[model samples]
Target: MKDQAKLASDPADWSIVETVDAVCAGHASALEVTQAVLDRIARRQPVLNCFIRIDGDRALETASGLDAARSAGRTQGPLHGAVLAHKDMYYRAGLVSTCGSEIRRDFVAQTTATVLDKLDNAGAVDVGTLNMSEFASGPTGHNLHHGNCHNPWNPDHITGGSSTGSGSAVGGRLVAGSLGSDTGGSVRLPAGICGAYGIKPTQGRVSRHGVMGLSFSLDNVGPIARTARDCARMLSVIAGPDPMDTTALPVPVDDYEADLDAGVTGLRIAVPKTYYFDDISPEISKLLDSALAVFTSLGAKIVHVDLPHHDIIGALGNAVGSSEQCTLHDFWHQTCPEKYAPLIRARMQAGFGVTAVEYLKALHLRSSIARAVSDAAFGDADVMFLPVLRFPVPTLSETDVGDGAGLHEILGSINHCTRPINYLGFPALTVPCGFSASGLPVAFQLAGPAFSERRLFRFAGAFEAANGLSDCVPDLP
Candidate 1:
C-alpha cells in the first residue's frame, strides 16, 4: 500500500480521510500522523485550554503498534492510524472520566464507553479526553471547575458548550475530530461557534452505554469534525445498534458518504417561520438568507414550514432533561451538593421541585410533541434549515447565565432552536456557513427524521460545497 508522497508534516492540515489514506498507503506512517497531532496539541493547549489532559505517551505507543501492523501487511480497520479525541464524558477503563464535574473529578471508570470501544475497533487513536461544561449542563463554555475552553478563533469569546473542547480541538486543527454527547445542543453549539461541522444523530442511532448520563432520554452521542465528510466517516464507524443499549435502534446503518456529493436537485429543504429567527440580529439573519440562496442555487427547493410549538418544545424539553439529569446526579446532590458548580447545583435542586405527576406528564407528552414537531418540520421535507445561534458569539462574561446579569435572557434564546430537535430525537447537522460581525463563526443547521443521518450528510455536504466555509481554519494569535 506504499504511495508516492507523505501527507503534510503538521496534523493540523490533515482531515480524517486524508490522514487515513496517507497512513494506510504508507505515504506516511501512523506515528508521523500521531506525532504531528501531539505537536499541535502541545502548541495550542496553553492558549486554548481545550484539553483536561493529554495522553501523548499512550497515543504514540498506539501509533507505533499500528505502524508495525501495517508493516506486517495487516490493516485493522477503516480509520487505521487516524487520531481523534473526545469530551471527558466518554469513559475509558482505568482512566478518569471527569464528566467535567467536581463530584467526579478523581473518579475513574471500570468500563470503557461503547463509543470509545467502537472507535478503537475501527483503528482510530484516542489521544485524550477533553474539557467540557460541568456535567454537560451549561450552554456557554463556562466551567468553574475545569476552566473554560477558549475559542481558537478568539480566545476571549466563548467556544459554546458542553462540547467545548471537541469543537475547539477540531476547529483549531489539533485533531481530525472528536466525539461529543448532545442532550441539549451540546454538540451543535460548539460546532457552530467554533466554525466546524458536527452531527447529532437520531437519539437511538448511537449507543449511550458507558457514557455518563446527563439526561438519559435526551442524551445522544455524535461526532464533530472540520467537514461534513469527516463527520460522515466517523458517524459510519461509531453508529448502529448495540445490545448494551436497548434504546439503540435495530435499523441498519447506511454508508453516509455514499451520496454525500449527490446533487440536491429536487430535494426539499424546509425553513421555519416561527421561533428560529426570532430576536436574531440582522447580521445573523443576513447570513441565513445568504445560505438559503446557496441551497436554492444547488437546485434544492426551499419550502416554508413552521413548528407552532417551537417555543414550548424547547422549554418542555428543558424540563424533561433537567428532571432526568437530577435523577442521574441525585446521590451527589443529596450527599455532597457543595461539589457542583453553584448554578448547576441550583438547577439540580430545582428538579426536585418537579413533582412526579409533572415529570410523568412531560414524559407522556414527549411522544406527541415529538410527532407534532416532526410532522411540522420534517413531514414533507428531506432536510430542514435552521439557525444555530441568533447573534454573534458573545464574550465569555456576557453569556455566563449563572452569573445572573441578564444572561438568562441571552441563554434562553440560545437553545430554543436546538433543544427542540433533541426533543424530537432526530438527526441534526451543523455546518459553518459564515462569520458574525465579531468575526466569530456562524452556522446553519439541517435536520432529518430519526436515523436519517445519510440525508442530513447529503444536504450538509452539498451546502458545504456551495458555501466554501469548511476549509477556513482558525488563526489563533
Candidate 2:
C-alpha cells in the first residue's frame, strides 16, 4: 500500500471502493482521508457553488470516531469512511434541510430519512448538503435561492438539475458519490451533463421516508457517483423495504455489486426509432453511434424498436407530477405563494387546472402504459438505450427560460427523455459516453423493466469498462 499521507493526499483520485479498502485496512486513517476531502472541497466549493453547507468539523469528528473503532478491532461496513453529500432534501433529525427554498430556509427535520440512516449505518460520513432546485421543481438547475450550480467542465454552463450539486460535486471530485432524487430527470440529467454515473432506481426501490416530497407519484431516490461500481455500492446500501415508507417495494434487494464485473457479452440493447432521437443534434447523434459501435464490438446486439406512446407519455407524466406537486404545496400556495420563484410557482399552478377526473385518468393509465411500453421496449431486448440529453449540454444562459411564455415548453424539452421512465416506474442508468463539441460531457441512458436495476448496472458497467469514460473528470481551476 502507498504511504497513508501520500495516498490520502489527493482524495479526488480515489474511488469509493478504494477509499473504503484503504481506511478499513489501515492504509489511511479515516480522519486523514476526511481532511483531504475537506481541503479539496474548500478549494472547489467557491467556484462550483455545489454545496449549500460545509460540515467540515462534524465530518472530521465522525471520521476520527471511525478510526478509533477500527483500532479497537471493530468490523466496518462497505462504506467504512467514504465521505458523501446529498441534495438538500433528505432529513436528518435536528439538522436544517433547506430543500433549496426560501420557504424552508431554516426548516429542521424531526426524523432522519431512511436512506441517510441506512448509509450512516453502513459507515458512510455525510459531509454536508448539496444545492438543488428550489422544491426540486425546475429542470434547468436554476435556483434563485442558492445560486445556480456551475458545471465543472465549464463554469459558464449549467449543471443539469435539480440534483445540480450532487453531480457537480461528484464530477469535480469533491466527493466520490452523493445521493440525488429523480422526479423527472434530476439524477440522470445532472450526472449525464456533468460526466458522472447516476441511476434512478425503479419507483419504490429506495424508501423515501423523511425526504422532501416533489411528486409523490413520480418521485424516486437514487445515487450519483464517479463510476458504475461506486453507484452500485451506494445503491446496495440504501435500497430495501422500509417500515416507514409503505411505498418501498417489499421484495428483497439484489446484491448490486456482485454482478458488476459481469460483462454484456450477449446482451440485447434496444434503441428507439422515434421521439428520443427526434431533436438530437448531429454531434450528439454521432457520439451515440460511436457508443453503439463500442457495444457492438463488445458482442452486445443493438436492436431498433418502435417504442409506443411517444406522443402522450410526456404530457401524461407532467399531469401526474404537477398534480401531486400542487397537492403537496396546497397550503403554501395559499399562504406564501410569493416565496416561490416565479417559474416554480407557475409550474405548481399548472396543476390547478387538472380536473380530478383528469388526474385520476392519468393515474389509472400508469400501469397499462408501463406494461405496454415494457412489452414494446423490452419485449425483444434485455434493456433499452436512449440519450440522456438530445443536444449538447446547455449553458446556464441558454437554458434560463425563467417565467417567460416558453417556460413550460423549455422545461418540458429538457426532461423529455427521462420523465416517461418515472411514469413507467422503471430503472435507468446514465453513463458518460463522450464529450460534446463544446467540451461538455454527453451520456447515454440504459433503462430496463421495473425493478431491473441489476441489468441496468450490468450494462453500464460493461460500457464503463470499455470506454473508460467513468475515469474521466473535468479539470477544475
**Reference-based TM-score of each model:** 0.97, 0.98
Q: Considering every candidate listed, which one attains the maximal TM-score?
A: 2
Clashes of each: 0, 0
In model 1, which residue pairs have backbone atoms overlapping below 3 Å? none
Q: Model 1, stretches more than 4 Å misplaced?
A: 1-6, 403-407
lDDT of 1 at 313: 74
Candidate 1 structure quality by residue, lDDT tens digits, 1-477? 332333444655788888888888888888988888898898899989999989999999999999999999998788899899999999999999888988889999999888899999888999999999899887788889989899989999999888999988988889889998898899999999999999989988998989999888899998999988889999999898999999888889999998889979999999888788788889999999999898889998988987866657766776788788888888888899888888778656667777787778878888887788788877788888989998888889777767454544576666667888898888999989998777899998898888788988998888888778766778863
Candidate that would win on lDDT: 2
Q: Model 2 segments beyond 4 Å from truth?
A: 1-9
Model 2, poorest ten-residue lDDT window?
1-10
